[model samples]
Target chain A: MTTLVLVSHPQLADSTSQQFLKESLPDDDIIWEHIESLSSLDVAQEQAQLRRADRIILQFPLYWYAAPAGLKQWEDTVLTRTFVYGDHRYPLADKELGIVVTTGMPRQAFQRGGAEGVTLDAALAPLAALAHRAQMRWLPVFPIYQFGYLEEPEKLQLVVDYQRYLTQPQPDSLANRQDWFAQRLDGMVARLAEDQRTTGRLIASVFEQNREQIDQLHDTLAMIKEQDDD
Target chain B: MTEQSQWLSQQIDQLAAQQEKFTDRAFWLALKQVVAEQDRRSEQLGGEVDGRTWRPDRW
Candidate 1:
Protein backbone atom coordinates (compact mmCIF):
# COMPACT_ATOMS: atom_id res chain seq x y z
CA MET A 1 0.00 0.00 0.00
CA THR A 2 1.06 3.60 -0.52
CA THR A 3 1.71 6.02 2.37
CA LEU A 4 0.55 9.56 1.90
CA VAL A 5 2.55 12.11 3.84
CA LEU A 6 0.58 15.36 4.15
CA VAL A 7 2.99 17.91 5.52
CA SER A 8 2.64 21.59 6.35
CA HIS A 9 5.21 23.84 8.01
CA PRO A 10 4.89 27.61 8.00
CA GLN A 11 8.42 27.86 6.72
CA LEU A 12 9.57 24.31 5.93
CA ALA A 13 12.22 25.47 3.48
CA ASP A 14 13.86 27.30 6.36
CA SER A 15 13.47 24.47 8.91
CA THR A 16 16.67 22.51 8.51
CA SER A 17 15.46 19.93 11.02
CA GLN A 18 12.05 19.48 9.40
CA GLN A 19 13.56 19.79 5.94
CA PHE A 20 16.10 17.05 6.65
CA LEU A 21 13.45 14.74 8.11
CA LYS A 22 11.08 15.31 5.17
CA GLU A 23 13.75 14.23 2.67
CA SER A 24 14.14 10.87 4.48
CA LEU A 25 10.85 9.48 3.23
CA PRO A 26 10.47 6.47 0.95
CA ASP A 27 10.22 7.61 -2.65
CA ASP A 28 8.45 4.83 -4.51
CA ASP A 29 4.76 4.31 -3.82
CA ILE A 30 4.88 7.12 -1.29
CA ILE A 31 2.80 10.20 -2.00
CA TRP A 32 4.52 13.38 -0.91
CA GLU A 33 1.85 16.08 -0.64
CA HIS A 34 3.22 19.25 0.85
CA ILE A 35 1.73 22.69 1.25
CA GLU A 36 4.56 24.99 0.33
CA SER A 37 2.17 27.74 -0.70
CA LEU A 38 -1.09 27.66 1.17
CA SER A 39 -2.37 30.73 -0.60
CA SER A 40 -3.02 28.54 -3.63
CA LEU A 41 -4.63 25.55 -1.89
CA ASP A 42 -7.35 24.32 -4.25
CA VAL A 43 -9.83 22.23 -2.27
CA ALA A 44 -10.33 19.90 -5.22
CA GLN A 45 -6.67 19.01 -5.61
CA GLU A 46 -6.17 18.46 -1.90
CA GLN A 47 -9.22 16.23 -1.59
CA ALA A 48 -8.11 14.25 -4.60
CA GLN A 49 -4.90 13.39 -2.81
CA LEU A 50 -6.63 12.40 0.39
CA ARG A 51 -9.09 10.25 -1.55
CA ARG A 52 -6.44 8.42 -3.54
CA ALA A 53 -4.15 7.39 -0.71
CA ASP A 54 -4.43 4.35 1.52
CA ARG A 55 -3.03 6.22 4.51
CA ILE A 56 -3.54 9.88 5.27
CA ILE A 57 -0.62 11.18 7.31
CA LEU A 58 -0.96 14.64 8.81
CA GLN A 59 2.36 16.06 9.87
CA PHE A 60 3.18 19.45 11.31
CA PRO A 61 5.34 21.26 13.83
CA LEU A 62 3.56 21.90 17.12
CA TYR A 63 2.34 25.49 17.07
CA TRP A 64 0.91 26.47 20.41
CA TYR A 65 0.29 22.80 21.30
CA ALA A 66 -1.57 22.13 18.02
CA ALA A 67 -1.18 22.04 14.27
CA PRO A 68 -0.12 25.10 12.35
CA ALA A 69 -2.75 27.19 10.61
CA GLY A 70 -2.35 25.38 7.29
CA LEU A 71 -2.88 21.96 8.80
CA LYS A 72 -5.88 23.20 10.72
CA GLN A 73 -7.26 24.54 7.46
CA TRP A 74 -6.59 21.26 5.72
CA GLU A 75 -8.44 19.46 8.48
CA ASP A 76 -11.31 21.88 8.08
CA THR A 77 -11.60 21.84 4.30
CA VAL A 78 -10.48 18.36 3.26
CA LEU A 79 -12.20 16.40 6.02
CA THR A 80 -15.68 17.60 5.23
CA ARG A 81 -18.75 15.55 6.16
CA THR A 82 -20.06 14.48 2.77
CA PHE A 83 -16.63 13.76 1.44
CA VAL A 84 -15.02 12.28 4.55
CA TYR A 85 -17.33 12.10 7.59
CA GLY A 86 -20.76 11.73 5.95
CA ASP A 87 -23.43 9.00 6.06
CA HIS A 88 -21.40 6.57 3.98
CA ARG A 89 -18.51 7.22 6.35
CA TYR A 90 -15.40 9.40 6.19
CA PRO A 91 -12.96 8.43 3.47
CA LEU A 92 -10.18 8.07 5.97
CA ALA A 93 -11.93 5.40 8.02
CA ASP A 94 -9.60 2.55 9.01
CA LYS A 95 -6.74 4.56 7.53
CA GLU A 96 -3.79 4.81 9.89
CA LEU A 97 -3.59 8.36 11.28
CA GLY A 98 -0.35 9.60 12.78
CA ILE A 99 1.08 12.92 13.86
CA VAL A 100 4.73 13.85 14.21
CA VAL A 101 5.14 16.57 16.84
CA THR A 102 8.50 18.25 17.35
CA THR A 103 9.06 20.23 20.50
CA GLY A 104 11.90 22.21 22.10
CA MET A 105 10.91 21.26 25.65
CA PRO A 106 11.86 18.05 27.40
CA ARG A 107 9.49 15.17 26.59
CA GLN A 108 8.71 14.93 30.28
CA ALA A 109 6.96 18.30 30.21
CA PHE A 110 4.37 17.00 27.73
CA GLN A 111 3.31 14.31 30.16
CA ARG A 112 1.70 14.83 33.52
CA GLY A 113 3.93 15.53 36.49
CA GLY A 114 6.83 16.34 34.19
CA ALA A 115 9.47 18.77 35.37
CA GLU A 116 7.73 21.64 33.53
CA GLY A 117 4.28 20.68 34.89
CA VAL A 118 2.41 20.34 31.53
CA THR A 119 1.49 17.08 29.84
CA LEU A 120 1.57 16.73 26.03
CA ASP A 121 -1.07 14.05 26.03
CA ALA A 122 -3.52 16.35 27.74
CA ALA A 123 -2.69 19.20 25.38
CA LEU A 124 -3.19 16.94 22.37
CA ALA A 125 -6.61 15.71 23.40
CA PRO A 126 -8.48 17.86 20.84
CA LEU A 127 -6.32 16.60 18.01
CA ALA A 128 -6.64 12.99 19.06
CA ALA A 129 -10.36 13.33 19.51
CA LEU A 130 -10.62 14.94 16.09
CA ALA A 131 -8.99 11.91 14.50
CA HIS A 132 -11.08 9.55 16.61
CA ARG A 133 -14.20 11.34 15.46
CA ALA A 134 -13.17 10.72 11.87
CA GLN A 135 -12.86 7.06 12.85
CA MET A 136 -9.27 7.18 11.75
CA ARG A 137 -7.27 5.12 14.20
CA TRP A 138 -4.60 7.16 15.96
CA LEU A 139 -1.13 5.71 15.98
CA PRO A 140 1.03 6.74 18.89
CA VAL A 141 2.26 10.28 18.35
CA PHE A 142 6.00 10.66 17.66
CA PRO A 143 7.59 13.50 19.60
CA ILE A 144 11.03 15.06 19.12
CA TYR A 145 11.74 16.73 22.41
CA GLN A 146 14.46 18.88 24.00
CA PHE A 147 15.22 20.38 20.64
CA GLY A 148 15.64 24.06 21.40
CA TYR A 149 19.41 23.69 21.06
CA LEU A 150 21.05 20.56 19.76
CA GLU A 151 24.36 19.09 18.66
CA GLU A 152 24.95 17.18 15.44
CA PRO A 153 24.35 13.82 17.06
CA GLU A 154 21.17 15.05 18.71
CA LYS A 155 19.83 16.17 15.34
CA LEU A 156 20.67 12.84 13.69
CA GLN A 157 19.11 10.95 16.59
CA LEU A 158 16.01 13.09 16.32
CA VAL A 159 15.65 12.23 12.62
CA VAL A 160 16.13 8.54 13.32
CA ASP A 161 13.55 8.73 16.11
CA TYR A 162 11.14 10.35 13.67
CA GLN A 163 11.65 7.56 11.16
CA ARG A 164 11.14 4.91 13.80
CA TYR A 165 8.05 6.62 15.11
CA LEU A 166 6.55 6.40 11.63
CA THR A 167 7.37 2.71 11.21
CA GLN A 168 6.94 1.30 14.69
CA PRO A 169 4.48 -1.45 15.46
CA GLN A 170 2.39 -1.35 18.61
CA PRO A 171 2.47 2.43 18.62
CA ASP A 172 -0.03 2.35 21.44
CA SER A 173 2.70 1.36 23.89
CA LEU A 174 4.51 4.64 23.32
CA ALA A 175 1.60 6.61 24.71
CA ASN A 176 1.47 6.86 28.48
CA ARG A 177 -1.97 5.22 28.38
CA GLN A 178 -1.86 5.22 32.18
CA ASP A 179 -3.01 8.80 32.65
CA TRP A 180 -6.44 8.18 31.07
CA PHE A 181 -7.76 8.32 34.62
CA ALA A 182 -5.55 10.81 36.46
CA GLN A 183 -6.29 13.29 33.65
CA ARG A 184 -9.91 12.38 33.13
CA LEU A 185 -12.51 15.13 33.24
CA ASP A 186 -15.54 12.91 32.72
CA GLY A 187 -16.63 10.17 30.28
CA MET A 188 -14.20 11.42 27.67
CA VAL A 189 -12.02 8.46 26.74
CA ALA A 190 -14.64 6.03 28.03
CA ARG A 191 -16.68 6.91 24.93
CA LEU A 192 -14.15 5.44 22.52
CA ALA A 193 -14.50 2.01 21.00
CA GLU A 194 -13.47 -0.92 23.18
CA ASP A 195 -10.27 -1.18 21.20
CA GLN A 196 -9.63 2.54 21.36
CA ARG A 197 -10.78 2.87 24.95
CA THR A 198 -7.89 0.64 26.02
CA THR A 199 -5.72 3.68 25.39
CA GLY A 200 -6.87 5.16 28.68
CA ARG A 201 -6.50 1.89 30.52
CA LEU A 202 -3.01 1.56 29.14
CA ILE A 203 -2.16 5.13 30.17
CA ALA A 204 -3.49 4.48 33.65
CA SER A 205 -1.42 1.32 33.74
CA VAL A 206 1.66 3.34 32.74
CA PHE A 207 1.01 5.77 35.57
CA GLU A 208 1.24 2.70 37.78
CA GLN A 209 4.41 1.60 36.01
CA ASN A 210 6.53 4.37 37.56
CA ARG A 211 4.34 5.66 40.29
CA GLU A 212 7.23 6.92 42.39
CA GLN A 213 9.04 8.61 39.52
CA ILE A 214 6.00 10.61 38.41
CA ASP A 215 5.10 11.56 41.95
CA GLN A 216 8.68 12.57 42.71
CA LEU A 217 8.85 14.66 39.57
CA HIS A 218 5.68 16.48 40.58
CA ASP A 219 6.97 16.98 44.12
CA THR A 220 10.19 18.51 42.87
CA LEU A 221 8.29 20.87 40.60
CA ALA A 222 6.06 21.86 43.48
CA MET A 223 9.04 22.55 45.69
CA ILE A 224 10.69 24.66 43.03
CA LYS A 225 7.51 26.67 42.45
CA GLU A 226 7.08 27.16 46.19
CA GLN A 227 10.62 28.48 46.44
CA ASP A 228 9.97 30.88 43.59
CA ASP A 229 7.02 32.30 45.53
CA ASP A 230 9.27 33.42 48.35
CA MET B 1 -7.03 -15.91 26.08
CA THR B 2 -6.93 -13.37 23.28
CA GLU B 3 -3.38 -12.80 22.13
CA GLN B 4 -3.74 -9.02 22.17
CA SER B 5 -4.86 -8.92 25.78
CA GLN B 6 -2.29 -11.52 26.78
CA TRP B 7 0.48 -9.66 25.04
CA LEU B 8 -0.49 -6.40 26.65
CA SER B 9 -0.64 -8.07 30.04
CA GLN B 10 2.79 -9.58 29.55
CA GLN B 11 4.14 -6.18 28.60
CA ILE B 12 2.51 -4.52 31.60
CA ASP B 13 4.05 -7.18 33.82
CA GLN B 14 7.45 -6.76 32.23
CA LEU B 15 7.28 -3.00 32.66
CA ALA B 16 6.02 -3.36 36.22
CA ALA B 17 8.86 -5.73 37.12
CA GLN B 18 11.44 -3.50 35.48
CA GLN B 19 10.50 -0.48 37.54
CA GLU B 20 14.00 0.47 38.53
CA LYS B 21 15.08 0.23 34.89
CA PHE B 22 12.57 2.75 33.55
CA THR B 23 15.10 5.57 33.50
CA ASP B 24 17.86 3.39 32.13
CA ARG B 25 19.11 3.97 28.60
CA ALA B 26 18.33 0.37 27.68
CA PHE B 27 14.61 0.55 28.49
CA TRP B 28 13.91 3.75 26.54
CA LEU B 29 15.88 2.46 23.58
CA ALA B 30 14.02 -0.83 23.64
CA LEU B 31 10.67 0.95 23.92
CA LYS B 32 11.57 3.24 21.04
CA GLN B 33 12.48 0.32 18.81
CA VAL B 34 9.28 -1.52 19.69
CA VAL B 35 7.02 1.45 18.95
CA ALA B 36 8.55 1.95 15.53
CA GLU B 37 8.34 -1.69 14.62
CA GLN B 38 4.69 -1.95 15.59
CA ASP B 39 3.65 1.22 13.76
CA ARG B 40 5.57 0.22 10.65
CA ARG B 41 4.01 -3.22 10.43
CA SER B 42 0.53 -1.85 10.83
CA GLU B 43 1.20 0.23 7.72
CA GLN B 44 2.25 -2.87 5.82
CA LEU B 45 -1.12 -4.42 6.59
CA GLY B 46 -3.03 -1.22 5.63
CA GLY B 47 -4.77 -1.12 8.99
CA GLU B 48 -7.76 1.11 9.48
CA VAL B 49 -5.47 3.72 11.03
CA ASP B 50 -3.57 6.26 8.91
CA GLY B 51 0.06 7.19 9.60
CA ARG B 52 3.16 8.43 7.81
CA THR B 53 6.06 6.14 6.89
CA TRP B 54 9.22 7.93 5.80
CA ARG B 55 12.61 6.32 5.11
CA PRO B 56 16.11 7.64 5.80
CA ASP B 57 17.07 7.91 2.12
CA ARG B 58 14.05 10.09 1.43
CA TRP B 59 15.44 12.66 3.82
Candidate 2:
Protein backbone atom coordinates (compact mmCIF):
# COMPACT_ATOMS: atom_id res chain seq x y z
CA MET A 1 0.00 0.00 0.00
CA THR A 2 1.21 3.52 -0.80
CA THR A 3 1.81 5.84 2.15
CA LEU A 4 2.17 9.63 2.16
CA VAL A 5 4.35 11.07 4.90
CA LEU A 6 3.99 14.82 5.35
CA VAL A 7 6.98 15.94 7.39
CA SER A 8 6.29 19.28 9.08
CA HIS A 9 9.39 19.97 11.16
CA PRO A 10 10.46 23.57 10.49
CA GLN A 11 14.07 22.52 11.00
CA LEU A 12 13.82 18.96 9.69
CA ALA A 13 17.41 19.01 8.47
CA ASP A 14 18.60 19.50 12.05
CA SER A 15 16.13 17.19 13.84
CA THR A 16 17.91 13.97 14.78
CA SER A 17 14.68 12.02 15.18
CA GLN A 18 13.05 13.19 11.92
CA GLN A 19 16.23 12.71 9.95
CA PHE A 20 16.69 9.17 11.30
CA LEU A 21 13.05 8.32 10.64
CA LYS A 22 13.31 9.61 7.07
CA GLU A 23 16.40 7.51 6.46
CA SER A 24 14.72 4.41 7.90
CA LEU A 25 11.65 4.49 5.61
CA PRO A 26 11.83 2.30 2.51
CA ASP A 27 12.43 4.22 -0.73
CA ASP A 28 9.63 2.35 -2.57
CA ASP A 29 5.85 2.76 -2.19
CA ILE A 30 6.17 5.80 0.05
CA ILE A 31 5.99 9.49 -0.85
CA TRP A 32 7.70 11.99 1.46
CA GLU A 33 6.65 15.61 1.48
CA HIS A 34 8.32 18.32 3.55
CA ILE A 35 5.49 20.73 4.25
CA GLU A 36 7.75 23.54 5.48
CA SER A 37 9.76 23.44 2.24
CA LEU A 38 6.75 24.47 0.14
CA SER A 39 7.36 28.08 -0.87
CA SER A 40 3.86 28.25 -2.27
CA LEU A 41 0.95 26.02 -1.39
CA ASP A 42 -0.52 24.20 -4.43
CA VAL A 43 -3.91 22.89 -3.27
CA ALA A 44 -4.63 20.72 -6.31
CA GLN A 45 -1.21 19.07 -6.25
CA GLU A 46 -1.50 18.40 -2.52
CA GLN A 47 -4.97 16.88 -2.96
CA ALA A 48 -3.68 14.71 -5.80
CA GLN A 49 -0.94 13.33 -3.57
CA LEU A 50 -3.49 12.56 -0.83
CA ARG A 51 -5.71 10.80 -3.37
CA ARG A 52 -2.85 8.50 -4.36
CA ALA A 53 -2.03 7.47 -0.81
CA ASP A 54 -3.70 4.64 1.14
CA ARG A 55 -2.34 6.04 4.41
CA ILE A 56 -1.38 9.63 5.30
CA ILE A 57 1.09 10.34 8.11
CA LEU A 58 1.53 13.79 9.63
CA GLN A 59 5.01 13.77 11.10
CA PHE A 60 6.00 16.70 13.25
CA PRO A 61 7.86 17.70 16.35
CA LEU A 62 5.50 18.81 19.11
CA TYR A 63 5.31 22.60 19.27
CA TRP A 64 3.44 23.95 22.30
CA TYR A 65 1.66 20.57 22.47
CA ALA A 66 0.41 20.84 18.87
CA ALA A 67 1.65 20.75 15.31
CA PRO A 68 3.61 23.68 13.88
CA ALA A 69 1.81 26.44 11.93
CA GLY A 70 2.91 24.96 8.60
CA LEU A 71 0.96 21.71 9.12
CA LYS A 72 -2.04 23.61 10.51
CA GLN A 73 -2.07 25.86 7.43
CA TRP A 74 -1.88 22.83 5.13
CA GLU A 75 -4.90 21.33 6.84
CA ASP A 76 -6.91 24.57 6.57
CA THR A 77 -5.95 25.16 2.93
CA VAL A 78 -6.03 21.62 1.54
CA LEU A 79 -8.59 19.57 3.45
CA THR A 80 -11.61 21.52 2.25
CA ARG A 81 -15.22 20.44 2.83
CA THR A 82 -15.82 19.38 -0.78
CA PHE A 83 -12.87 17.00 -0.71
CA VAL A 84 -12.85 15.80 2.92
CA TYR A 85 -16.35 16.16 4.34
CA GLY A 86 -19.80 17.13 2.96
CA ASP A 87 -21.89 16.00 -0.06
CA HIS A 88 -21.34 12.27 0.58
CA ARG A 89 -18.08 12.59 -1.38
CA TYR A 90 -15.38 11.89 1.20
CA PRO A 91 -12.22 11.43 -0.87
CA LEU A 92 -10.27 10.34 2.19
CA ALA A 93 -12.78 7.73 3.29
CA ASP A 94 -11.27 4.33 4.08
CA LYS A 95 -7.80 5.85 4.18
CA GLU A 96 -5.83 5.93 7.43
CA LEU A 97 -4.60 9.02 9.30
CA GLY A 98 -1.51 8.57 11.46
CA ILE A 99 0.52 11.02 13.51
CA VAL A 100 4.21 10.69 14.25
CA VAL A 101 5.17 13.09 17.05
CA THR A 102 8.43 13.81 18.84
CA THR A 103 8.86 15.50 22.18
CA GLY A 104 11.92 16.83 24.01
CA MET A 105 10.19 16.10 27.33
CA PRO A 106 10.01 12.61 28.78
CA ARG A 107 7.00 10.43 28.00
CA GLN A 108 5.77 10.48 31.58
CA ALA A 109 5.39 14.27 31.56
CA PHE A 110 2.38 14.12 29.24
CA GLN A 111 0.12 11.96 31.39
CA ARG A 112 -2.72 12.93 33.75
CA GLY A 113 -0.61 13.04 36.93
CA GLY A 114 2.58 13.96 35.12
CA ALA A 115 4.21 17.38 34.87
CA GLU A 116 2.24 18.29 31.73
CA GLY A 117 -1.06 17.30 33.41
CA VAL A 118 -2.50 15.84 30.14
CA THR A 119 -2.02 12.72 28.10
CA LEU A 120 -0.52 12.77 24.61
CA ASP A 121 -3.84 11.53 23.26
CA ALA A 122 -5.59 14.50 24.86
CA ALA A 123 -2.88 16.87 23.58
CA LEU A 124 -3.38 15.72 19.99
CA ALA A 125 -7.18 15.57 20.17
CA PRO A 126 -7.58 18.11 17.38
CA LEU A 127 -5.76 15.93 14.88
CA ALA A 128 -7.89 12.95 15.85
CA ALA A 129 -11.00 15.11 15.43
CA LEU A 130 -9.79 16.14 12.00
CA ALA A 131 -9.43 12.51 10.99
CA HIS A 132 -12.92 11.76 12.28
CA ARG A 133 -14.42 14.73 10.44
CA ALA A 134 -12.74 13.59 7.23
CA GLN A 135 -14.09 10.01 7.61
CA MET A 136 -10.61 8.52 7.93
CA ARG A 137 -9.46 5.76 10.28
CA TRP A 138 -7.28 7.25 13.02
CA LEU A 139 -4.30 5.09 13.81
CA PRO A 140 -2.51 5.16 17.17
CA VAL A 141 -0.05 8.02 17.77
CA PHE A 142 3.63 7.13 17.37
CA PRO A 143 5.56 9.06 20.02
CA ILE A 144 9.31 9.52 20.14
CA TYR A 145 10.17 11.06 23.49
CA GLN A 146 13.50 12.72 24.33
CA PHE A 147 14.98 11.71 20.98
CA GLY A 148 18.16 13.72 21.50
CA TYR A 149 19.21 11.64 24.51
CA LEU A 150 18.63 8.13 23.16
CA GLU A 151 21.64 5.85 22.79
CA GLU A 152 22.67 4.19 19.54
CA PRO A 153 20.85 0.89 20.25
CA GLU A 154 17.62 2.65 21.27
CA LYS A 155 17.81 4.86 18.18
CA LEU A 156 18.30 1.81 15.96
CA GLN A 157 15.31 0.09 17.55
CA LEU A 158 13.27 3.27 17.13
CA VAL A 159 14.09 3.34 13.42
CA VAL A 160 12.83 -0.22 12.94
CA ASP A 161 9.71 0.36 15.04
CA TYR A 162 8.92 3.66 13.29
CA GLN A 163 9.13 2.01 9.88
CA ARG A 164 6.80 -0.79 10.99
CA TYR A 165 4.37 1.69 12.61
CA LEU A 166 4.06 3.58 9.30
CA THR A 167 3.69 0.53 7.04
CA GLN A 168 1.95 -2.09 9.23
CA PRO A 169 -1.57 -3.02 8.13
CA GLN A 170 -4.57 -2.95 10.48
CA PRO A 171 -5.36 -0.58 13.35
CA ASP A 172 -3.07 -0.30 16.33
CA SER A 173 -4.58 -2.77 18.77
CA LEU A 174 -2.99 -4.99 21.41
CA ALA A 175 -3.69 -8.10 19.38
CA ASN A 176 -2.13 -6.64 16.23
CA ARG A 177 0.97 -5.55 18.15
CA GLN A 178 1.27 -9.01 19.68
CA ASP A 179 1.00 -10.60 16.25
CA TRP A 180 3.74 -8.35 14.91
CA PHE A 181 6.07 -9.35 17.73
CA ALA A 182 5.18 -13.03 17.24
CA GLN A 183 5.94 -12.79 13.53
CA ARG A 184 9.33 -11.24 14.29
CA LEU A 185 10.05 -14.00 16.80
CA ASP A 186 9.14 -16.62 14.22
CA GLY A 187 11.58 -15.13 11.73
CA MET A 188 14.31 -15.08 14.35
CA VAL A 189 13.61 -18.69 15.24
CA ALA A 190 13.87 -19.78 11.62
CA ARG A 191 17.38 -18.38 11.34
CA LEU A 192 18.77 -20.04 14.47
CA ALA A 193 21.28 -22.93 14.31
CA GLU A 194 20.19 -26.48 15.23
CA ASP A 195 21.92 -26.22 18.61
CA GLN A 196 20.06 -22.96 19.34
CA ARG A 197 16.67 -24.31 18.24
CA THR A 198 15.69 -25.20 21.82
CA THR A 199 15.73 -21.54 22.87
CA GLY A 200 13.67 -20.69 19.82
CA ARG A 201 11.12 -23.36 20.72
CA LEU A 202 10.83 -22.00 24.26
CA ILE A 203 10.31 -18.48 22.98
CA ALA A 204 7.66 -19.70 20.50
CA SER A 205 5.80 -21.48 23.28
CA VAL A 206 5.80 -18.30 25.36
CA PHE A 207 4.50 -16.32 22.42
CA GLU A 208 1.72 -18.83 21.73
CA GLN A 209 0.60 -18.59 25.35
CA ASN A 210 0.56 -14.79 25.15
CA ARG A 211 -1.37 -14.97 21.87
CA GLU A 212 -4.09 -17.00 23.58
CA GLN A 213 -4.55 -14.28 26.20
CA ILE A 214 -4.65 -11.55 23.53
CA ASP A 215 -7.24 -13.53 21.55
CA GLN A 216 -9.38 -13.88 24.65
CA LEU A 217 -9.22 -10.13 25.22
CA HIS A 218 -10.24 -9.48 21.59
CA ASP A 219 -13.16 -11.87 21.87
CA THR A 220 -14.36 -10.23 25.08
CA LEU A 221 -14.20 -6.80 23.45
CA ALA A 222 -16.20 -8.04 20.45
CA MET A 223 -18.83 -9.57 22.75
CA ILE A 224 -19.17 -6.24 24.58
CA LYS A 225 -19.72 -4.47 21.26
CA GLU A 226 -22.33 -7.06 20.24
CA GLN A 227 -24.17 -6.55 23.52
CA ASP A 228 -24.11 -2.80 23.03
CA ASP A 229 -25.56 -3.21 19.53
CA ASP A 230 -28.35 -5.42 20.83
CA MET B 1 23.39 -17.36 16.09
CA THR B 2 24.04 -13.84 14.82
CA GLU B 3 24.13 -10.77 17.08
CA GLN B 4 20.70 -9.64 15.83
CA SER B 5 19.28 -13.10 16.50
CA GLN B 6 20.70 -13.03 20.03
CA TRP B 7 19.06 -9.66 20.65
CA LEU B 8 15.78 -11.06 19.33
CA SER B 9 16.00 -13.95 21.75
CA GLN B 10 16.54 -11.55 24.64
CA GLN B 11 13.52 -9.54 23.58
CA ILE B 12 11.39 -12.70 23.32
CA ASP B 13 12.42 -13.67 26.83
CA GLN B 14 11.45 -10.24 28.13
CA LEU B 15 8.09 -10.43 26.36
CA ALA B 16 7.43 -13.84 27.92
CA ALA B 17 8.16 -12.42 31.36
CA GLN B 18 5.81 -9.53 30.68
CA GLN B 19 3.03 -11.83 29.47
CA GLU B 20 2.93 -13.69 32.78
CA LYS B 21 1.78 -10.52 34.56
CA PHE B 22 -0.34 -9.06 31.75
CA THR B 23 -3.75 -7.47 32.34
CA ASP B 24 -5.44 -5.07 29.94
CA ARG B 25 -6.14 -2.31 32.44
CA ALA B 26 -2.79 -2.41 34.21
CA PHE B 27 -0.76 -2.85 31.02
CA TRP B 28 -1.55 0.63 29.75
CA LEU B 29 -0.95 2.19 33.16
CA ALA B 30 2.36 0.41 33.50
CA LEU B 31 3.39 1.48 30.02
CA LYS B 32 2.67 5.11 30.87
CA GLN B 33 4.69 4.87 34.06
CA VAL B 34 7.67 3.30 32.29
CA VAL B 35 7.65 6.01 29.60
CA ALA B 36 7.44 8.73 32.23
CA GLU B 37 10.42 7.39 34.13
CA GLN B 38 12.66 7.06 31.05
CA ASP B 39 13.74 10.69 31.04
CA ARG B 40 12.63 11.86 34.47
CA ARG B 41 16.12 11.90 35.98
CA SER B 42 17.65 13.62 33.01
CA GLU B 43 14.94 16.26 32.97
CA GLN B 44 15.27 16.82 36.69
CA LEU B 45 19.00 17.35 36.27
CA GLY B 46 18.61 19.84 33.41
CA GLY B 47 15.58 21.69 34.85
CA GLU B 48 13.15 23.45 32.55
CA VAL B 49 14.50 25.91 30.00
CA ASP B 50 12.57 28.84 28.57
CA GLY B 51 11.24 27.83 25.13
CA ARG B 52 9.58 31.12 24.14
CA THR B 53 12.36 32.19 21.78
CA TRP B 54 13.34 28.66 20.71
CA ARG B 55 12.75 28.50 16.99
CA PRO B 56 12.80 25.06 15.32
CA ASP B 57 15.03 26.38 12.53
CA ARG B 58 17.50 27.82 15.04
CA TRP B 59 17.78 24.55 16.99
TM-score of model 2 vs. true structure: 0.63
Candidate 2 DockQ vs. native: 0.03
CA-based DockQ, model 1:
0.02
The ten-residue window of minimal lDDT in model 2 chain A covers A209-218
Question: A107-203, model 1: which lDDT tens digit per residue?
Answer: 7676667765666666678878877877877777777675567775465445435544454334434233223223331243354346544644673
User: B1-59 in candidate 1: lDDT tens per residue?
Assistant: 33553565465444434434222222233333443444343334332111122225536
Candidate 2 per-residue C-alpha lDDT over A42-88 given as tens digits, one digit per residue, 9 for 90 to 100: 99999999999999999999999999999999999998888887778
| Per-residue lDDT value at A162 in model 2 | 74
In candidate 1, position A54 carries an lDDT of 62
lDDT scores in order: 0.57, 0.71
